[model samples]
Target: MPLDLPSDSDTATLAETFRLLGDPTRLRILFFCLEAPRSVGDIAESLQLSQSLVSHHLRLLRGARLVRGNRLAKQIFYELSDKHVSGMLADMAHHVREDD
Candidate 1:
């Protein structure tokens, strides 16, 4: 059967998403938030990145809908936007580990 392709706008959006995921720092941040919601401080400390840097990356990730944040009091905790994001990440990780 022939596959249906995305519209040009959707293709551009998907490309943009891939470009956002291409950054090493952003990718690390996404992986860090894979398991559970994490505050900027928690992620920064665990990843050994400055809080400001983490915040910057989070903003971009949030813009791309790759991650979402929930405000709890004065702190906001971030996690993967949905299972689709996690599933894609997991699939890619598995793909990388496969024997060539």
Candidate 2:
């Protein structure tokens, strides 16, 4: 199937959001964020991934505006950028379970 491209700014935003969700690691990171804001260390520990690898995925997610990060003390905490991400994930979860 061919991928659709959004012509306008709004569609472009949607396209970017889809791109962010296309990666499994990014999806897992988003789920982790859904629970609470976490630092790269927290993500690494929870996901059992190396810090460098988690940081790499985080950089892409941040660039896509799917997630936001803030510095507190010495650690950078990340969370979902908007409510839509959580809504989309919830919808996806429902569809996946329906398929089973």
Candidate 3:
């Protein structure tokens, strides 16, 4: 089956998204949020990263629509934006583990 390509601007946006996912820190953060929403402090502590660093990365991820945050009291918990993002992460993980 043939795949239809997106327009140039859309392609650029897609490429930027890939670029964002290419970062190890951002990728780790995404995986951390894969199962459930997590607070910045929790993600930082679990990932051994500074809360500020996690917050910075989260801002970028949120900007790209790769993740979404929901405010609960004074804390904002983040998770994968939708099933599509989760599916992509899962599919990529499977792909990397596949034998040649």
Candidate 4:
């Protein structure tokens, strides 16, 4: 369930969003998904994870509404749920950069 917050709750949402991204496995999944909608098998292969393990992580991501899936034939392809994830990642990278 979504937390009930006052009118100004952008930070709450952002915090929750980042919390979901805190896991390294989840971070890799998000980056891979950002590249293209991919099948569980593809993610497993690329990340060197078993299909079952990848599926488990995907389930968590789906539960958080951070990823979306599309079925093609007997396979399901996954992608980011919205542009917010991409935008947040980009903004984070920009702000977290070190001085030259």
Relative to the true structure, how large is the alpha-carbon lDDT of every model?
0.89, 0.88, 0.92, 0.86
**Which candidate achieves the best lDDT against the true structure?**
3
For each candidate, C-alpha RMSD in Å? 1.4, 4.2, 1.4, 5.2
Tens-digit lDDT track for model 4 on 1-73? Answer: 8878655477776677778799888888888888799999999999988899899989988987899999999
Ranked candidates (TM-score, high to low): 3, 1, 2, 4
* Number of backbone-clashing residue pairs for each candidate, in the order shown: 0, 0, 0, 0
> How displaced is residue 30 in candidate 2, in Å?
0.7
lDDT of 1: 0.89
Cα lDDT tens digits for candidate 3, 1-100: 7788889999999898899899999999999899789999899999999999999999999998999999999989999985776899989888999888
- TM-score of every candidate relative to the true structure: 0.89, 0.80, 0.90, 0.77
Measured by C-alpha RMSD in angstroms, how accurate is candidate 1?
A: 1.4
Best by TM-score: 3
Candidate 2 C-alpha lDDT tens digits along 63-92: 877789999999999998878778888788
Off by over 4 Å in 2: 1-12
Question: In candidate 2, how many Å is residue 63 off?
Answer: 1.1
Report how far residue 14 has shifted in candidate 2, in Å.
2.6
Candidate 2, poorest ten consecutive residues by summed lDDT: 1-10
- By how many angstroms RMSD does model 3 differ from the true structure? 1.4
